[model samples]
Every structure is written in structure tokens, then in C-alpha cells.
Target: MEGKRLYVGNLTYSVNEAQLRELFSKYGDVVSAKVIEQKGFGFVEMGTSEEAQAAMDALNQTVFEGRTLRIDEARPMQPRREFDRGGYGGGAGRRY
Candidate 1:
């Protein structure tokens, strides 16, 4: 893929960082692994893009921890937009 980071989804609640790292190490050197607790997802980074692709190819749609894993290249986070405080142009023609 375009990046070495991978998005690992459909994870069981019990999976941890060490377990994820170990699971991916089978494909290549795992740079990092983090399982988001209670989120049923995580991120795994490999030493290189090739390694990450290999992991994704081998692991995607496979069963792990009693669930099918969904693996793919992780996308970069976009900046969050500021929340709108009110609707109707902030006034709605009503005066305070």
C-alpha cells in the first residue's frame, strides 16, 4: 500500500498490543502494534510498506480470535472541523 501502517479491525476485546505485534511478526518485522481497548480495532505498523502489504494480503478476511479480521492500509487522519454552535445563520431572525 501507500503506507507502512495498517488498520486492523474486527478484533476481539481481549487482543492486546503484544499479541498483535506477535501476530504480524509472522509476516515481517512489526514496527509497532496497538489494540484500542473496547473499540474492536487497532493499528499495526510494519518496518516497510512491503511488509505491511504482505501482512494485509495474508491476514485480511481471515479468522482471528473468533472473528474475521479486516486489515488494510491505514489512512492518515483528517483535521477535525470546528463544531457549529447554532443553526439558521446563528440567529434565525430572533433577537435576544
Candidate 2:
């Protein structure tokens, strides 16, 4: 693992940050845990890369909260580009 952050997927919608933090803490120090309720996924940050790797190894494909978990190293967020509406007449102009 290159980074301490891990992307946890296949989580039950009911899972919360506290539960996630407690689960990952078993492998090592957990810096933070965040569960995106609507998305059914979350991110966990460990204190070190080794810890993150260990957690990933132990937790991936494991069942939790009635769902199988998917764990992987978190990827960096891609930059968002502004959409151009040149020909679509998307500005303040004509009422439909």
C-alpha cells in the first residue's frame, strides 16, 4: 500500500463511521473513518501504509453488517472539469 487511505466498499447502508473505525482499528491505528450513507461505501485512513495494507488483507471480501466488504487502497480524486454549454443555450436566456 502506497498510502494510508483505504477505500471500503459493499458496505451496508446502516454502517456508521464508529463501526468502521472500530473494525479497522483491529489491524492498527486508524486515523479516521467516514461512511457515506447514501453511497454504501466509505474511506478509512490508517496511521501508516503497513497498517492499511494489513487491514486491507484481513478485511477484503469479509462479511460485515450482512454484506461482503471490498477493501482496496484509495485512489486520489480526479480533478473536475467545468462543462461548456456553448451551443446548448444553457445560460440565463430563453424560457422553455
Candidate 3:
């Protein structure tokens, strides 16, 4: 992997940061682990690209917590922008 960060998907809802850290630590030094409880996914930051790749190779498509894991290089997040409703019904009296 080119990036040190890995995107972990298809995670079980009960998985947490500590569990993620413990899992990835076997491959190499884990910089951080963050599990989004509601999204059912998380990001694991490894100390190096090699470690990230190793983790990906070893864990991707493997079953964890009764779910198949989807592991890949984490992509940079895109900037968020406010959407324009284009004057679509703001209220009972407003319509276009």
C-alpha cells in the first residue's frame, strides 16, 4: 500500500478501537485505530507503508467478528460542500 492508513470495511458493529489496534498490531506498529460505531467501518494507521500492505494482505477478505473484512489503502477525504436545493420547497408556502 502507498499510504500508511488502511480503510477497514464490513466490520461488525461491536468492534471498537481497542480491538482494531490489537488486531493490526500483529502486522506492525499501529499508529492509531478508529472505529466508527454507527458506520460499521474504521481506519487503521500503521507506522509504515510496508506494515499497511502486510496487514492488508494478511487480513483482507478474512472473517472477523462474524463478518468479512474489506481492507484497502485509505483514500484522502474529499472536501464537503453544501448542497443547493435549487429552490425546492423550503416550507409549506415556498415552492418552485
Candidate 4:
């Protein structure tokens, strides 16, 4: 959609990068694949947006590793904003 990078969700914890590559490769060239450990999700970068779309179209609702896959364009990560908690320097700590 937006770019070649695609966000692959609804994955089982056991799914790995190589599995992703193998699955996506059917639609087109898999540029890269990464499985976020313990997150049950990963990223797959196809050779082009068209490839990504094809993969998404074919595999979005398909079951893999006992779970339905959710494929879509990866969104740019938003920067985390740090909030300032009032300067309370280690208030009298007594094991709660």
C-alpha cells in the first residue's frame, strides 16, 4: 500500500522469519522477513508494493501456524514521547 514493507500480524509465537519468507515467496520475491519474538507478529518486505499487495491479498485471511494472518502496509513508527513526572527524587522509600 504505502510502501513495500508490510506488517504481518496474527501469527503464532512459534512462527519464525524463515517461515515467513517461505510463505511470502509464493507471491513474489521476499526481500526480508523478521519475526518479533514473543510478540506474535512480524514484518515482511516484498520486492515491490505490488508484490506486497499480492501477498496480502492471497494470505491476509489465511491460516498459518494455527492462526489467521493479518497482512497490511507497515505504518511508520511514531516516536515515543517521554513525559516528565514532577521532580520527586526517590521519595522516602520504605518497602511497600
Models 1 onward score TM values of 0.87, 0.85, 0.87, 0.85
Clash numbers, per candidate: 0, 0, 0, 0
Worst 10 residues of 2 by lDDT: 86-95
Candidate 1, lDDT over the whole model: 0.92
lDDT of 2 at 21: 99
Q: Predicted candidate 3: what Cα RMSD to the true structure?
A: 3.0
At residue 15, give the lDDT of candidate 4.
Answer: 88
Query: Model 2, range 34-68, lDDT digits (tens) per residue?
Result: 99878999999999999999999999999998999
Which residue segments of model 3 deviate by more than 4 Å?
Answer: 87-96
Clashing pairs in 1: none
Scanning candidate 1 in windows of ten residues, the lowest lDDT window is 83-92
Clash pairs, model 3 backbone: none
Per-candidate Cα lDDT values, in order, are 0.92, 0.93, 0.93, 0.89
Where does the lowest 10-residue lDDT sum fall in candidate 4?
Answer: 86-95
Per-residue lDDT tens digits for candidate 1, residues 1-96, read: 689999999999999999899999999999889899999999999999999999999999999889999998999989977554565455655577
Q: Give candidate 1's total backbone clashes.
A: 0
Choose 2 or 4, whichever is better by lDDT.
2
